[model samples]
Every structure is written in C-alpha cells, then in structure tokens.
Target chain A: MFSELLGIAIIFGATVLLAIPLGLYLATVYRGDKSWSDFLAPLERLLFRAGGIDARRGMSWQQHLMALLTINLVWFLFAMLILCTQGVLPLNPDANPSMSPDLAFNTAISFLVNCNLQHYSGESGLSYLSQVVVIMFLQFVSAATGMAACVVVFNALKEGTNEKLGNFYDYFVKSLTRVLLPIALLVALVLVFQGTPMTFAGKQPLITLQGDTTAVSRGPVAAMVAIKELGTNGGGFFGANSAHPLENPTYLTNMVENFALVLIPIAMVFALGFYLKRRRLSYMVFGVMTAGFLLLLAPTVYYEMQGNPAIAQMGTDMQLGAMEGKEIRLGAAASAYWGITNTIISCGSVNSMHDSHMPISGMSEMLGMMTNAFYGGVGVGFLNFFVFVIIAVFISGLMVGRTPELLGKKIEAREMKIAIIVALLHPLMILGGTAMAAHLYVSNPTEYAGWLANPGYHGFSEMLYEYTSAAANNGSGFEGLGDNTPFWNISTGVVLLLSRFLPVIGPVAIAGLLARKKYTPESAGTLRVDTATFGLMVFFVIWIIAALAFFPALALGPLAEHFSLY
Target chain B: MKNNFASAFRLTLALLVLCCGVYPALVWGAALLAPGQGQGVQVSHKGRLVGFENVGQKFDWPEYFNSRPSAVGYAADGSGGSNKGPSNPEYLAEVNTHVAAFRQQNPSVKPGQVPVEMVTASGSGLDPHLSPAGAYAQVERVARLRGLPAERVRALVDARVQQPIFVLLGPSKVNVLQLNLALDSLSGR
Candidate 1:
C-alpha cells in the first residue's frame, strides 16, 4: 500500500516539478513583450513568413474564433493528403500501403483538432515520411493550437477595448521552439535511456517456431512516443501500447512514460497563474484539480489492492494481484496510477487494459475522463482550466454582491453564458453519446465475454464505455466493444468533432469579451482569484459539473459492472 | 555589427549542431547501450537469434510458451485487435478452440482450469512469453514427449525465470523462448 502511494506521488511530483519553469516560460512567451533569448527572436519571425501566415495579423475575438476553425480545417486536409498518399513514400522496403479514405480523414482531422484518434498503429502503418509529415507534424501543431488559445485568453484578461488578442504567429513559434520542441527532445532522450526503441531499421526478419517467416515492426518510435506524451497525445507506436516490451521495457521507462504523459498538463496550471502574473491562481487551480484528481487516484489503489472478489469467489490463486489485463512488474500500482494519470490529464495511454479493471477502479478512471482529462488536449488542458476560472470569477462576483470582474473585465451575460456552455459541453457530449451508443449498438447481452460472460448489466457497461471513450477523446476502449466497424467509426468521429470544437468556442468567445474590458483596481469587496477560499469553490464547481453530468450515467456503466463482479 | 554577426552565426551553428549532430547520435548511443531492451528482447537459438517477444505473451506449447493474445496480427505496424465483443460468437469460438487444442495436447491437466492466458490472444497479438502457470502446464507434456522427468522440466521452468527486468514494470515473468531452448538443452531434443 505504501509503495503504491509512493509511486503515485513520484509521478505527480515529477510532473509538478516540470510545471514551474516551463509554466513561467509559457506565460512570458505568450505575453510576447519580452525579447526571447537574444538569439531566438529573428528565427521566430522567419518561421511566420514561411508558413504564409502574416506576422502582423493580431486577431479580434471574432477573428480568433474563425482562425481556429479555419486552421483546424486546413490542417485536417493537410493530414488527410499525407495519410492517403503515404503508400508511395520512403522507408517502405515492403511497400507498406496507404490508409483508406474514411480512416484517413478521420485520423487527419482527429490529430489536427488534437483529438489524436489513432485508428492505425504507428510502428507499421506510417512510413518515415507520413510519420514525420502527417503524425509528428500534427503533434507540434496541435500542441501549439492549445498554447495559441491560452495566449488569446491571456490577452483577453489584459484587454482594455483592444481588438488584438495576442500574436498568433508568435504564439505558434514560441510553443514550437520554446515549450513543445525542447521538452519533447528531452523526454525522448530520457525514454531512450529508460529503454524505448529508436531505430530507422526495417522489421528484423526472423523465422517463427512453425517455420513460417515473419517480420518484426520497427521505426522512429522513440521520437513520436516523446511528443505523444509531452503533448498529452497518447497513441502507441504498436497496438500493445506501452505494454509492448519495446515501447516500455523497464520500471524506470514506465515511470518516465507516465511522467511524460502528465508533465505538460500539470505544468499548464502553473503556467496559467505565473503568465498572468498570478502565481497563486495557478497553484490554486492546480490544488483544486489535484484534489479531484487524487480522489479518483485513492479509490483506484484501494479497489485494485482489495483484490478482485471474483478471483476469490472462483478460489483461484490471485497472489499476483488484479491479474486480469495487468502485468506482474507494473502490478496494481501501474494499473491504478495510469488510470489516475490518464483521467487526470486526458492522455489515454494505458499500460494495462481498463475494461478488465475492477469496477470502482474503472469508475474512477471514467470520472477522471469526465471531470478533467485537462490534461485535456495538450494546450487544451489550460484552455479548459481558464473556462473553470471564468466560472470561478462569476460565482465569486455574486458572493461578494458585485459584478463578476475577472482580469479587469466584467463577467456579464455573454461571458457567463459562454462559460456555462463550456462547462456543459462535456456532459452533453459524454453522457448523451454514452446513452445513444448503449441504446443503439450492444444488443447481445448474454455470452458477452467468456470469462466475465454473463447476461445483462456488465455488457451494457461495455457499450457505455465505448461511447464515453469516443466523446471524451479518451481513445482507450473497453476491448469488449466492436468499434472498428463503420457504425462506430462515423459516430465516434462525429462525437469527437463536436466535443472538441463546441467546448473550445466558449473559451474563445469569453477571452474575446474579456479582452475588451479594462483592468480595474482591486478593493476590499473585489474578488481575488488566487486565494485559497476561491480555490475551494473552483474545485467544488469542477466536481459539481462532473457529478451532475456523469454520476447517473456512470451508474449504468463501469459502476454496475464493478458491483456485478463481486 | 561585425562582432554581433559573428556571435549570432556561432549561436545558430551551435543550435544546428545540437539538432543534427547531438540529438540523433545521443539517441543512437542510448539504443546501442541497451540492446537487450524493449523489442530488443530476442530469443537466441545457440549462435543464431530467432525473434523478439513482449513480456506479455503466453507460452503453453511444451516446445514453447505462447505469447499473450495479440489480436493485432504480428505486424508491429498494424497494432490493433479483432474489436470483437467478448460475447460475440467469433470471440467465444476462438477461445473455445484454444481450450480444445490445449486439452487435446496436454491430457493430464484438469478441464475448465486451464490458465486464462492459454485460451485468449493478447491485445497486441505478438506477445513472446507465457505465465509460469502456462509454462508449468506445458512442462508435463514437453517432458513426456522428450522422455524426461517432470521434475527436471519444472526445474528448467524455475531456472529460466527472468524475475522481471524491473519489479515495477509488470508481473514477475519468464521469457518463453529462453525456457524452451533451455528445455531442449536439458533433454537434448
């Protein structure tokens, strides 16, 4: 028990340690006034001109909104072109084929929009060119888009009737050069040290036992694995995910991978408060988010350690702990920890299968998906955090009997309305999507799983999990759902599109409104977002949104399955 | 201006060197240092090496412990599963066939108590080891087929146990290929 707690703490601490300087750097970079290291300034300008993007085009809230949509659309097409045409590209000794159109558009838009919907495996499907251009390229762009949204909001907080949000060209460069690139390179090196494979060689051909020849999958996996975690994008190079011996070979490597997953999302909290010249506010947000994140973590360790009552009922030796879908080396600590981390930040990389996870353990993971997943999309976590901040601002204003003023802007009907939509966006997508998937697909309840195979509720939970995973962009499946079919493909794709954009527009509009208001002087009655009291409210509000949104539905899915097993 | 230009040139040159020279070479250095890591876990047949297996695979065949269920065909590039609901007739059929095959080959084992891994494929479908139970279940058959004592076969299983490379990485596991080759050495198969 102690060891598991220590393991969870190590992962959380390592992530927060990174948040400090990186957060400070992000804040200053987005502010765009300071000269970035004497050497990096001109190079930044050069990149803007090369992309055909205007360096001088500072945006209004309206323009910023359009730019996000336009940029995502353009990137979707770019990613699609690369995926469909990857067949003829280099690094194909066996001439690996191209993706079909439906998958191509789905994947391309998914990555560009930061959903990272990985329908194909990275080690085999992608050639060197597609890996670099389509997949890796989108990682950087998707990460930058999140940073770009935060900068717009940062400027909105500082706005005094100014049309300019911040510099988009500059945000792109700063995110790419300063934050995302350096961190990705660092984590990749660490993973290499911890034993993730990094090779450009073809699959090492070897004869199988029966004398049939087969080729092993190999590629530039280490580089992509690094960005996948740093950007909070958790697609695996191979289908075994981090469980593959090559992808995650050691205990240290497992720890490193888990750290890489949450590092950025946690750091963005500090980045928020620090960049806004409100360090306390970032800590406060971190504190609230951490409280909710930890609640999920606690039960995860407890239920898995309590051992599966089913294993006891069957009277089989389970000294190996929750042996279903978990590795002996990773043990319950990894299953519990990865579940907590994925839910906490929304990175969805799994060391063990979650569908086979104990019921309460699975519920905590689902709650994490519903509540924060902020480590939402890469820069998306911070964008989501800011939405919570606006809500905090409105509620505090009402408590003090004053107009809710955040970063000098009045929280009027427009901003509050947008915040409400952003807050509700997840519920509508997650709960509604789960209900629809449950009702439509999943008809054959009996003989669902040969082991967990029984008639009724357990199977229904599996159906609910499939849709929740899709709508939340969580990506980890129940392994029990037949999701590769066109029915799942189209529905999941549509849910992914709406969940991603609708929630995003709310923050964009709020940031725009905030940008127009001037900063006001703080008085005794004025609310300070950085205080401990306000922090508690933000935590409760986040919980309220999650509970109101998900608990009843959760009762239908993982929660019920958890009880039935016992 | 000239001095400023010289320093800027040097800085860019260093950045270029860092991106091109240091990064790629460092990664290469790390790869070579840990040749036994990740997909690098190869099964050697004397002087010749055969293949790699993830620690997650099952090994039930007396000649070899099978890898875990990897529904994704062994194409490392095409990582995925049958995505079949466990309730689906197809999945059940596959599981039952695995059970039938195991029962036919190893007659000594009690029915309905076959280790779970023997019956199901791993999610990746390319695992390379079996559970100790899985390896032990096959011990009797491999020994009888080779005309060796069952204790000796079990001893080989005990010997090949590679207490996980790191305890925190996964469950304590033994490599399937290593155990099989060692079994061959013992029985001179």
Candidate 2:
C-alpha cells in the first residue's frame, strides 16, 4: 500500500518535473521566436519548397481548420485504403487477412482522430505492413495533429487582432520532427532495453516443459509502444495492451509508459502558460486539472485495493487485494493509478483490465473519461478544457455583472454558441449512442446477444463505457464488450469523427474569432481567470456539467454495480 | 488550396520516411546495446532453454511453486485476462472452482488462508511473477513434497522475492520460474 501510494506520487511528480521544462521548450518551438532547431531548418524549408508552401504565408483560422480537416481526410482515406488491402501487402508474414469495410472505417477514423479505439485484436487483426504503415503512421500524425491544432490556438491567442495565424503545414511538420520524434526516440530506446520486442519476426512457436506448444506473436512492438504512449496514441500491439509481457515487459517499462502517457498533455499545459506568458494562469488551469485527477484517483485506488467483497463471500480470501484482471507485479494500487491516469490523459493502454475492477473503480474511470478535460489528450486535452473555460468565463461574466471578456477579447453569443454546442455534443453522442445500443439490446436481444459479454448492470456499464470512451476520444474499453461488430464499428466511427472534430473546431474557432477582434485592456471590472476564485469556478463548471449530463447513467452503471456488490 | 494540398501530400511522404523508417531503425539499433537484445531474459535448465523469464509458464505440480492462474491457459501468444466483472456469475463460478482446485492441491492450507492470487487469473494470462505472499503460501506444500525443511524453503522464497524498482515503483514479487529452478538445484534434481 505504501509502495502503491509512493509509486503514484512519484509518477505524478516525475510527470510535472519533466513536463515543466519540456513545456517551455515546446512553447519556444511553437512561438518560432528562436531557432534552437536551426539544424533542421534547411530540411523544413526544403519540404515547404517541395510542397509550394511559402513559410511566411499565414492562414486564417478558417484556412487553418481547412488544412487540419483536409489533411485528416487524406489520412482517413489512405488508412482505409491500406487497411482494406493489407492482405496482399508485403510484411504480412502471419498472413493476417484484410479488415471488413466497417472495421476499416472504424479503425481509419479511430487512428485519424487519435482516439485509437481498436475494435479488433492487434495481433490477429493487422498484418505487419498495416501495423507499420497504418497504425504506427497514424500514431505519429494523430498526435502531431492534436499538437498542430493547439499550435493554431496558441497563434490565435498570441496575436491581438492579428489576421494571420501560423501555417498549419509548418506547425504539423515541426511538431512531428522537433517535439514528438526526439522524445519517442529516447523512450523507444528505454523500452527496447527493458525487453519490449522490436523485431520484424512473426510469431515464434515455443514448446514448454509441460509439453504445451504455444505460438508467441512478435513484431516491431517497441517502436509502436514508445510513440503509442508518448504521442498519447494508445493502440496496443496486442489485444491485452500494456498488460502483455512483450508490450510492457518490466516494472521499469511500466513506469516509463505510464510517465509517457501524461508527458505531452502536461507539457502542453505548461506550454500554454509559457506561450501566453501568464505562468500563474497556467498554474491555475493545472491546479483544477490536478484536483479533477485526484478526485477520480482517490476512490479508484481506495476501492481497487479494498478487494471485492463478493469474491470474499465465495470463500476465496482476497487479502492480497483485488487480483482478478490485475498483475501481481503491478499490484492493485499501481493498477488503479494507471486506470485513472490512462483515462485522464486519453492514453487507453491498460496494464490492468478495467473490466474486473471494483464497481466504483470502473465508475471513476468512466467519469474521468467523460469529463475528458483534466489534462486530457496531447494538445486536444486543453482545447477540450478551454471550451468549458469559455462557458465558465461567460457565466462568471454574467454573475460578476461585467462584460464577458477573455484575455481582452469579448466572449459574445457566437463564441458562446460554438462552445456550448461542442461541449453539449459530447453528452449527446455518448447518451444518444448508448440509448440506441440499449434499445437494440432489449428489442433484438438475439442479434446483439453476444455484443455484451457480461449480463445485467455490468453489461450496461460496458455499453456506456464504449460510447463514453469514444466521445471523450479515449480508446480504452471494458474489454468484456464483444464490440468488433458492424453496429459498434460504424456507430463508434461516426461518434469518434464528431467528438474529435467538433471540439477542435469549437475551440479553435473561438480562439480564431477572438484573435480577429480588437484587443481590450484589462480593467478593475474584468474577472480575473488566474485567481483562485475563477479556478474553483472552472472546477465547479466541469463537475456540474459532468454531474448533470452523466449522473443518471452513473446511477444505472457503476453506481448501481457498487451498491449491489455491497 | 491546391498548394496546401500539395504541401500536405509531400509532408506526409517525408514524415513516413522519418517517423516510420528511420525512427524504427534507430530504435532497433539502440536495443542492440541493451542486454538480451530485446529477445527477453531466457531462463535455461541444463543448457536447453526452458522459457523466457518474463513470461509465465504453467507450474501446477505440488513439488513446484505454482504460477498465477492464466485466463488463456498460459498461452503466451494470445495473452489476456478473464475480462469478467466482479459480480459476474461465471467469473464467480470459475473462482470457486479455482479455489476448490487450490484446496485439493494444498490440502494442509485452510480455505480462508489461500491467497486470492492463487485463485484469480492475472491481467496478462502470462503473469510470470507472483506476490511474495503468493509464493510464501505455497512454500509449505513445496517443502513437504521435496522433503525439505519449511524454514529453508521460506528463506529461499524470501531470497527470491524481488523488491520493487528503487523500492517504490512496483510490489515485491517472486518470479515463479526462477524460484522453481532454485528448488531443483536445492533438491539436486
């Protein structure tokens, strides 16, 4: 218990310690104020020249959005094409078959959006060529995509009524080369050292002393895992994800991967502080996020360590903590910590199966993903949080009897409308999809009978967790959901597209709209967002919004599950 | 717009090389510098390789320390958990059966005293290590079967228990395969 507590503390401490400096560096990289990466400047310029991208040609927020959308469209098409044709492709030594059209669509969008909600098992579902070309490719770009979007927000925020935000092409390329690549490289080396396989070999057959022949699947796992964690793209090389020995391997690798999950998201938060030159405001945002994180973490760790009473009733002593669906090496406390952190950061790789967690622990995980803004995914996490920040600012503006202005720009009906729609859309997709699934589940039980692997309240939780994970752009599942069907694939594909883009559009649109407005100076009447009062307000706004939208769903799922267990 | 499209195309191809090709090659190169060369630490018995130390193998015999129960029957290929909720009836039944089997195997140990790790399937079906408590619980069975003193076996289990990384990263665990090999050496098998 002490070790688990200490491990969580160290992980959280290490993330902040590493992120602060990395955040500053990222800020400098985004601002382009200095040329520390001058060595790569020639290569960057060459690529720009090759593509006819004038480095100085700035984009309007609309143009930036267009570029972001267009590139994503291209990726979706490319990924879909490859996924549908990977059967005949080289490097498929295992001869893995092509994906069905619906699965391809789901997978393509899943990777393109950086959600990576895989419906198919990694070892069997994809060939090596597809894994390298599609999965690994999307992991890098999807992460870069998020960071690129945030760079747009940074540019818009930096300029006071300036018409030109930075070029999307420039930001996209630079984020990949300058920021994500180096860190992933270092992390990849560490994983490889700790025994994650990087070979291109297929599954090796092993004959145990017990005379059982098992075929072990091996691939370029180390490469994928490094970026998968670092980029906040949590697609597993295997179905069990980080729980697999080859994927995580050792305690050292587990720490490395967990640290990697929150690395960029936390760094991006600090980057916001440095970029805006308002360190205190950044700290305020960080504080609220930390509070939300701890709110989820405390219960998850406590209940997961408490062991399932129902199991104890069955005459099995659970004094060693909840061992079901958890590794003894990681133990219960660290596993609980991983669940919270993974959901909070939108890194869905699990060292422990969340499906077997205590009912309340599952609830905490689902709630964390639903909020989706407590130091969320790569660059998009803050963008998601910023939507609430707009709503909070507008509401506080009304409360304090002042005009709603953020960073000297007025928050009028247009900005408020977009923010509200995007913020509201998450619950709409989550609840609406869940309703459809639940209706289908009851009305046509046989057709979708196997859709949910568990029955009753836990079954409902599985369905709820699926949509929640998708809408939040988090890709972890209860694992018990037999979700590799057309219904799930297409349904979640649509949800993934909307949930991912709308938030990006809403946040960047607000930032862009604000950037074009004339700068207004701060006055005594201005509500200070950096103050503790406003931070608390933001915290309450997030909690209130989550509680209102999800409280009923919670009542049916983990909440009910928890009560029934007792 | 066309220029922007062209830029996007060119950049994608460029990054494909850098990220996909060059990056993986570089990582693979660095892995060679590390011990075991990313094939994992293989535990061998009498020169023939037994198994990877990091991966779990089935050890159901009373004379040996039992590894964690696997959901996939210790298949290293498709490693996973018994993705069952705590309240699921099937999971409870399975646990009950596992408890019965454990009681049958270690008759001297009380039902309540049997550690949960012995009955539950791990997240990775291939959980190579067991908690120190899990290992210690089986010490008596292993000691009696091998005609060794329980105190000596306890010392061996204690010695094989690995402290968490830097004493704060993970839990204390004993690699079941390594412990069993030590037993073989002690028994002069």
Candidate 3:
C-alpha cells in the first residue's frame, strides 16, 4: 500500500517538477525569445519558405481560425484517402485490408479532431503505413493545431487592444519544432531503450514452451506510443493500449508514459502564468484543477484497491484488488491513478480496461471527462477551462453586484452567452447522444443486441462512456461497447467534429472580443480573480454546472451499478 | 481562403515528411543501440526460441505454474481484456468456475486461499507477471506434480520473486515464464 501510494506520488511530483521548467520554456518559445532550442530555427525557416508562408505576418482571430480550419480540412481529406486505401499502400507487411468508408470517416475525423476514438483495434485495423502516415502524423499536427490556437488566445490576453495577435503559422511551426518534436524524440528513445519495438518488422512467429505456435505483433511502436501520450492523442499501437507488455514493458516505462500524459497540459497552465504575467491567477487555476483531480482520483484509487465486492463474494483472496482488467506490473493503485489522469487531461489512454473497473471508479472516470476542464488536453484543456472561468466570473460578478471585468475586459452578455453555450454543449452532446443510443437499444433489443457486452446498468454505461469520451474530445472508451458499426462510427464522428471546433472557436472569439475592448487598469473596486476566494468560487461553479448536469445520468449508469453491487 | 488553402496544402505535405518520415526514422536509428535491436527481447531456452521475455504464454500443464486466464487465449498477435464489468453475472460466474477449477487442481489449498489474480484475466491478455502471492499459491501443486519437495519449490519461487524497483514503486511480481524455466532446470526436465 505504501509503495502504491509512493508510486502515484512520484509520478505526480515528477510531472509537476518537469512541468514548471517546461512551462517557462513554452513561454519563451511562444514569445520567440532566444533559448536552447534555437537550433531548430533554420528548419522552421526552411519549412515556412517551402510553404510560401510569411512567418512574420500577423493574424487576426478570424485569420487564425481560418488557417487552423483549412489545414485541418486538408489533413482530414488526406487521412481519409490513405485510410480507405491502406491495403495497397507501402509498409503493410501484415497485409491488412482497407477501412470501409464509414470506418474511414470515423477514424479520419477522430484523429483530425485530436480525439483518437478508435472503433477498430490497432494491430488488425491498420497497416504499418496507415499507422505512421495517417495516425501518427495526425497526432502530431492536431496537437500542434490546438497549441497554436492557445497561443492565439494568449496573445489576445496581452495588455493591449490590437487586431494583430501573432502569425498562426509561426505558433504552429514553433509548436512542432520547439515543443512537441524534441520531447517526442526524447520519450521515443527512452521507450526504445526500455525494449518497446521500433523496428519495421511484422509479427514474429514463435513456438511457446508448451509447444504451441503463435505470433507476436511488432512495429515502430516506440515512436507512435511516445506522441500518443505526449500530445495527449492516446491512440494505442495495439488493441490493449499501454496495457500490452511490449508497448509499456515495465513500471519505469509506465511512469514515463504517464508523465507524458499530463506534462504539456499542466505546463500550459504555468505557461499561462508566464505568458500573461499573472502568476497568482495561474497558480489558482492549477490549485483548483489539482483539487478536482484529486477528488475524482481518490475515490477511484480507494474503490479499485478495495477489490470488486462481487468478486470478493466468491471465496478468493483479492489482495491484488480487481485484477480482472489490470496488469500485475502496474498494480491496481497505479492503474486507478492513470484512469483519472487520462480522463481528466482528456488524454484517453488506458493502462487498465475501464470496463472492468469498480463501479465508483467508472463513475470517477466519466466525471473526469464530464468536467473536461481539470488539467485538460494540451492547449485545448485551458481553452475549455477558459469558458468555465468566464462563466464563473460572470456569475460571481452578478452575485456581488459588480461588473465582471477579467484582466480589465468586461464580461458582457455576448461573452456570457458564448461561455454558457460552450459550457452547455458538452453535456448536451453527451446526454443527447447517449439518450439516442439508449432509445435505439431499448426499442429493439434483438436488433442491437451486439451493441453491448454486458447487460443492465453496466450496458448503459458503455453507451454513455462512448459519447462522453467523444464529446469531450477524449479518446478512451468502455471497450465493451461494440462500437465499430455505422451507427456508432458516424454518430461519434459527428460528435468529435462538433465538440472539437466549436469550443475552440467560442473561446478564441471571446478572447478576441475582449482584446479589442478598452484596457482599464486595475483598481480597488475590481474583483481580484487571483485570490483564494475567487478560486473557490470558480471551483463551486465548475461542480455546480459540470457535475450537477451529469448527476441524473450518473444515477442511471455507474452510480446505479455502484449501489446495486456494493 | 484561396491563399490559406495554398499554404495549408504545402504545410501539410512539409509536416508529413518531418513528422512521419524524419521523426520515426530517427527513433529507429537510435533503437539500433537497444537490446534485441528494438525488435523486442525474446527469451530462448536450450537453444530454441520459446517466446518474448515480457509477453505471457499459456502453461496449463500440472507441472508448471499456470499463467493467468487470458481473454484472448494468450494470442500475442492481438491483445485485449475480458472488459467484463465487475457486477456482470456471467463474468462473475466465470470467475467462480475458475476458482472451482483451481481448488480442484490444487486440492491441498483451502477454497478461499486462491489468489484472485489466478482466476481474473489481465487487461493486456498478455500480462507476463503474477503477484508474489499468486506464484506462492501454486508451489504445492507444482511440487507434487514434479515429485519435488515443497520447500525446494518454495525456495525456487522465492528466488524468482522480483521486488518493485527501489522497493518503492509498482508491485512485487514473479515472471511466470522465467520461474517455470527455472523449475524445469530444478526438476531436470
């Protein structure tokens, strides 16, 4: 127990320690100040020249969105084309077939939105060419897209009313050359040294000690797995994800991968502190996010370590605690810790099968995505939290009978409307999608019998989890859902698309509008957002809005399962 | 929009080369320094390749410590978990069946003494290690099957027990494959 606690503490402590320096470095890179990574400036210049992009040209908020969308559209089409014809492409040593059109649509949109909601298993579903060219490529660019958009918001938040923020291509290229590529390379090398396969070789046929012939899957997994966590893309190279021995290999590798999961998201918060010169405000945001993270994390770790009561009813020693869908090397505590981190950060990678977690733990996982703002995915996480901050600022301002002026910009009806819509959009899509799925399942049980792997409340959870994971732009799932069909693929694909862009547009628009407003200096009358009082207010607003909206849905799924089981 | 499209198209192509082509190739080059040349570390026994050192294989024979139940039947080519929710009746019944079978196989052990990991399936369907308690549970049955003393088998299990790194991270576990191979040498199989 002590070791398990220490294991999680070490992972969390190391991530925070690493995030601080990374945050400072991120601010430097985005600010275009000189640093150690300046050697990559030549490469960035070459790429910009090749693309005919003037890196010095500044962009308005609308221009930033346009560049982001156009590039994303191009990538989506490219991904679709490759996915549909991967069988004939090069590097398919296993000779996997092409995806059907619906699957291709789902997959392309999933990766493009930076939500790797894979309906198909990796080893069989994709050839090695698709794995590298489409999946891994999208993982890098999509995360950069989010980070670049975040920098736009950061520029807008600076103390000036200026139409010209910064060049979209500048932030985009620097995100790749400075932030993601260097870190990904470092992590990939570590994984390779730890024995994760980085070769182009296909599956190796082996004869077991028991004289049975079987084959082990191999690929350039080390490279893909690194960014899969680092960028918060969370697409696994194999069906079991990080649970696979070769993919993760050891406890040390698990720590590395887990550290990568939260590093950038947490760093972006500190980067906000440095970028905005609002260190107190950033610390308050970090504090609230950590408190919410631990709230969701504690129940999951406790429940997972308690062993499944249903299994405990049987005559067996469950000292290992709920080992059904967990690795022995990782143990239950670490897996529980990962479940919360992945869900909260919207990384959506799993080292354990969430479908088999104790009921309360499953609820905690869903709640993490439901809130979807606590240390969220890379750059987009803070954007999601930004909406909540706006809403909280407005609500608290109303209660105190004062105009909500955030960083000297007034929070008016227009900003409040956008914030509310963006906040409400999460629950609407999740609940609406799950309701539609539930209705479909209930109306004709026999027709969609294969949709669920388990019966009753747990079955409901599988459907709810899929939509929540999608709507949050989170890629993890309750794998028991037979979700590769046209119904699921198309529905979740639409959810992924809508959820990814609109939230981004709304936040950037609000920030842009506020940037154009007259900058009023701080005074005694201004409600200080950096104070502990305001932080608690924001925390309450998040729980009241995000958590309360999902309570009834919770009652029907994981909560129902918890009550019945325990 | 046209200007944006032109730049977007060019940038996308440029990034593909850098991200997919250059990056993975660099990692692959560095992997040459790793053990097994980054193809995965394989375990060989008596001049024959048995399996990967990290991937679990089936060992149903009475003389060997049986590996954990696998949802995919230990198929290394594909991996997955049972994904059975904790309260699913059918899944629970399956666990009970495993418990019953384990008790029947190891008759000297009490009904409640079986380690849960012995019955439950792992997430990867290829978990290579068992908790130290899981390995110790099978000592009696394996010793009886091999005509060896229980203490000798216990000592062998003890020798195979791998402590968590720095004794402060992860769980103490025994790799079933390595332990079984050591047992084979002990019994002169």
TM-score of each: 0.84, 0.97, 0.99
lDDT by residue for model 1 over A180-222, one digit each (tens)? 7677787777776665667767777776543546667766667
Candidates ranked by DockQ: 3, 2, 1
> Individual DockQ of the candidates?
0.19, 0.69, 0.87
TM-score, prediction 3: 0.99
Predicted complex 3: CAPRI docking category: high
Give the alpha carbon lDDT tens digit for every residue of B75-167 in model 1: 554544444332334445665666677777778777645665555444445555566776777777887877888898898889876664333
* Tens-digit lDDT track of model 3 for A146-184: 999998888888898588889999999999999899999
By summed lDDT, the worst window of 10 consecutive residues in model 1 chain A runs over: A445-454
**CAPRI band for model 1:** incorrect
Ranked by DockQ, the better of candidates 1 and 3 is: 3
- After the best TM-score superposition of candidate 1, give how far the Cα of residue A310 lies from its true spot, in angstroms: 2.6
Give me the chain B TM-score of candidate 1. Answer: 0.72
lDDT of 2 at B85: 94
Q: Report the error of model 2 at residue B53, Å.
A: 1.7
lDDT of 2 by residue, A13-61 (tens): 9989999999999988877867577687787787677666776778889
Best by TM-score: 3
